[model samples]
Target chain A: MSAVWSITKKELVSYFTSPIAYIVIAIFILLSGFFFYSLVWWFNTQAMQMAQNPYYFQQININQMVFAPLFHNLSIILLLMLPVVSMRLFSEEKKMGTEELLFTSPVSVIQIILGKYLAALIVLLAMLVLSAIPTIFTFVHGNPEPVPYLLGYLGLFLLGAAFLALGIFWSALTENQIVSAVLTFGTLLLFWVLSWAAYSARGLWQDVLNYLSFFEHFDGMTKGILDTSDLVYYLSFAFFGLFLTHSVIQFRRWR
Target chain B: MIETEQLTKKYGDLVAIQNLSFRVEEGRIWGLLGPNAAGKTTTMRILTGYLPATSGRASVAGYDVFEQAEAVKQSIGYLPETVPLYPEMTVESYLGFVAEIKKVPAARKKAAVDRAVQIAGLQSVRKRLIRNISRGYKQRTGIAQALIHNPRVVILDEPTIGLDPAQIKEIRDLIKSLKGEHTVMLSTHILAEVKEVCDGVVIINEGKLMASGSLEELARSFSQNDGVYLKLDRADGEVLNLFRQLPGLKEAALDGAEIRLEWPWGQDLRTQVLKLCLDKRLEIREMRSLAMNIEELYLRIVSGGMEQ
Candidate 1:
């Protein structure tokens, strides 16, 4: 356990000691703030116009206007940014030859992979915390639903954990950080876009696909529903990716 | 002690090493001598548990390299040809990471890093980032990372390959200082390093062991006899011819005013040569026996007598 903690702390320190952590956080917050401000401003203007109307129009559906799109946009922003933050987790070490140093040590392959994965997870968590700043507007300026906000964050955390694990696996497969970043971005894009593809298609098979869609589950979190199945799905995704990463590193030892 | 029985490594159709069998007894520094691409790094990698052999068993410190690789890795500290370091990390932080991964206790980790830094003469640069340090300092950092855990066996591959003469001497001396407490297996093309620091030398060529023994034993086995050089005042062909025809002299060559005579066995031919020179009235400036140096003997064995 000390070995794992040692590697985790070392990786975490490396993340903060360089400009990468701050740069990634800056970009993530900047993009997320731009999207959040635009959405909330447009929705708040429409609500103001509805209040001034001579005829009532169901009070402009303010709850969905504030929480529903916030959840959706937050998920998309995280999907785009998490891959960039996680791309260097193992790829840089493999490129720099430090992978051999780690492999030759007495620590098992499990400890090394898990340590690096957890550190990247922590960085993603920090990004999640930063994303909450824009979400604070929903509570102060509009009708606040703390339940949905907290649950949506739980969903975002789980989703980002899953993506981070896959990103780590991709990073381990190559020595080039750009290749890892691009591949991870491509994989996340597929999952993000496929959720809508399944939602649009109308068939029995499509219904099954929509249920499997990442957004289908993430949408529940936006509504403040703690679905056990979505939790299982995201957890399994993270677990399997990490499992494959462990096996890949072990296979590299024999070769 | 370390032992490998027919350890082999094959990458696709290319065989890096085949049937490499050797042993290093406890408390000795063994040199793995080979030219480039002769499987020195491959052999070290197998022993370090970085790569598994295609067929055969390697046991280090009584643990099988394949079956008990974790134990083997615990016992061995390996410095590869290209030392992998985190450029962003300071020398102290890097060594601390190594000690941690190698399972040095937390209380002792600081002392372990300090000891390795001291041994590699890296105290002055301990706080500097690895990327900013000199190449020699980087190489020393590599050594320090490997030695941080105080493993029973230390393996270095081409430890002094890219260093300047001074750095090379410093690293060689560092390896020399590690003689008794640790069993070291260092591979290098510098034959003189083998003679200076190694207790036994293992020579490999074309992925096979050409010879394995101490320097003197190897020289004695391959060289027919120690050659004798005689610098004479007279440089006549007739004098060289007469010296070649003397009893117990197997061969003789003349270069300028010097004559080199080979004797197959240790016969007291110096008296005969002196008497012949006196009778011929030729002045002898210098006469000394020249034993074959380690380089020539190593080349002769590895190349099977072919030389440029």
Candidate 2:
């Protein structure tokens, strides 16, 4: 456990000391802030128009009108930004020959992988926390349901964790960070678009695609509904990606 | 402290090392001497638990390298051919991190780093970032990281590959100082380095062991006969003829003012030669045994001039 923490602390220090962490955080906050502003503006305009009619005004809630779109936009932003956060985790070690030091040390491979994975998760958490600033405005000016609002951020965190794990696996595949990032982005985009193909498919194929799509699992937590299956899906997806990373590292050692 | 038996590694059909075996006793410095692509790094990697051997066994500090890798790693320190360092970290922080992962206790981690810094002579640049330090300091930092945990065996692959002569001497001196407490196995292609620092040598070429012994032992084993040189004040054909009369003389030659004579191994003719020179009224200037240096021994072994 101390070995794992040592690796984690060193990785965290490296992440913050380099320009990659700041640049990634800056871009995520900027995009999420813009999305929040536009969504809230559109929500205000729709609320004004709906207030004249009682039936339409009943449908206007802050959770669905403003926060839901913002959460969805933040997920997209995370999908793009988290790969950059994870690209250097293993790629830089291999490129700089530091993997030799790491492997020759007494620490296990799982500890090293978990250390890097947790560092990326921490960066993802930081970005999520910073993006919550715009949501705080809704809490102060209007009464947004705190439960669903917090759940939406929970969904986003789980989604980002899954994306970061896959990114780490891709990073472990190659020494070139660019290639790792591109492969991660491409694989995540494929999983993101799986639901689009599900719409045209018939029978069990549609259900399988929907179940496999990240959008399906993340959609429920955006609202007030917290399904155990959705939580299990994200956690299992993360575990599978980490398992693949471990296999790759172990295979490389013997090869 | 370190031993390997028939350690072989094969990448598909290509052999990296085949039937390579050597032993490094505790508290002695051994040099792994070989040409480029001679499997020196591969052997060290296997011994350090960085890579697995295909069909052999290795042990470090009484732990099996493959079966008990973690235990072996805890007892060994390794520096690869490329000095692996985090360029963004200061030398002290880097050593601290190494000590942490190497499982130094929390209370002793700071003291471990301090001891390593003192031993590797890294105090001058301990606060400097690795990227900004000179190459010599960076190499020392690498050594410091390896020693931070105070492992029983230290394996350094080409530790002085790229340094100025002064820096090389400094690094060599540092390695020599590790003779009593640490069992060091350093790989180098420089023959002079082995001559200067190593107590014994393991020479490999083309992925096979050529020779392994002390410098004098290797020299004596490789040469067919023992030889001596005699410098005289006056030497002519008469002196050569006088030396040729000695029994059991394998060969004799006169060059310039010196006479070179060779006899079978284990033969001592020095007293006879001195008596002959004294009775002949010849003045002697300098006389010394002609033993092959490491350079000649390495060349002969690597070139396959002598049988393994």
Candidate 3:
């Protein structure tokens, strides 16, 4: 456990020492802030126009009007940005020859992998925390339900973790950071469009594609529905990605 | 402290190291001598548990490299051919991280780092970022990282490879100083390095072990037939004939007032030649017996002059 923390500390220090952490966090905030501002603007315009109608105005819940769409937009932004955060985790180690040192140390492979994964997750968590600052305005000015709003953030975090795990798997495949980032983006994009493909399909194929799609599992969480099935899907996706990464690293040693 | 038996590694069809075997007793310095692509790096990687062998057994500090890898890793410290370092880390922090992972107790981590820093002469650059330091200092920092845990066996692959002469000397001295406390195995293609620092040598070429023994044992075994150089004031053809007439003198040739003689090993012909010189009234200016240095021994063994 101490070995895992040692690797995590070293990785965190490296991320901050370089410009990568600050740049990624800054870009995420800028983009999420833009999305939040535009969504709130649209929500205000609709709320004002519907003021004369009692029934429609009563249905104008801030949770549905502003926060839901914002959470969905934040997930897209995370999908685009988390790859950059995870691209260098393993690629830089192989390129710089530091993998030899890590493997030859007393630590196990699982420990090293978890340490790096946790560091990237911490960076993801920081971005989520900073982006929440804009959401705090909704709580102060309007009466948005706190439970569903927090659940949306939880959904975003799980989705981001799943993205990071796949990114880490790609990073372990090659020594070039650009290659790792592009491959992660391409694979995530494919997973994103699986549900679109499911729309044209029929029967069991549609059900399978919908189940495998990253979009389906995240939908319930944004609506404040705590389904065990969605939780299982995200956690299993992350575990499978980490398992593949471990196999890749272990295979290289024998080869 | 370290031993390998029939250690073999293959990548698909190409064999990196084949049936290689050697040993390093406790408190001794052994050199793995081979030229480029001689599987020196492959052998070191296998013994360090960074790579597994296809077939064979290896152990470090009484722990099998494959079966008990964690124990073996904890007991040995290795510096790969390329010094692995994080450029963003300070020398001090890098050693501290290594100590932590190497399982040095929390209370003693700082002391271990300090001891390694002092031993590797890294005090001057301990606080500086690794990328900002010189190459020599970076190499020393790599050495410091390896020693921070104070393991029983320290394996370094080409430790002095890219340093200047003075830096090489300093690194060599540091390696030599690890003799009594740590069993050290260093790999190099430079014969002079083996001569200078190593007590024994394991020579390999093309992934095959050519020879392994102490320096003197190798020299003696390969230099069974010795030679002598005689410089005299009057080394005419008649003097050469007189020297050649002595029994057990294999061959004597004259060239410009000098005569060269060859004889079997362990034969002392100096007195007989001196007697002949005195009887012939020849003035001997210089007389010396030629002893084989590491260069000749290494060349002979690597060039296939001696059978495996």
Better of 1 and 3 by DockQ: 3
Best by DockQ: 2
DockQ list for all candidates: 0.66, 0.83, 0.79
lDDT of 2 by residue, B165-196 (tens): 99999999999999989999999999999999
Sorted on TM-score, best first, the list reads: 2, 3, 1
Please report the TM-score between candidate 3 and the true structure: 0.93
| lDDT (tens digit, per residue) of candidate 1 on A64-113 | 67667866787887777778877888889888777878888888888988
Arrange candidates by lDDT, highest first: which order?
Answer: 3, 2, 1
lDDT of 1 by residue, B142-175 (tens): 9988788898999998999889999999999999
* Candidate 1 to truth, TM: 0.88
DockQ, candidate 3, comes to: 0.79
Worst 10 residues of 1 chain A by lDDT: A54-63
lDDT of 1 at A32: 73
Indicate which candidate wins on TM-score. 2
Worst lDDT 10-window in candidate 3 chain B:
B219-228
Q: Which of 1 and 3 is ahead in TM-score?
A: 3
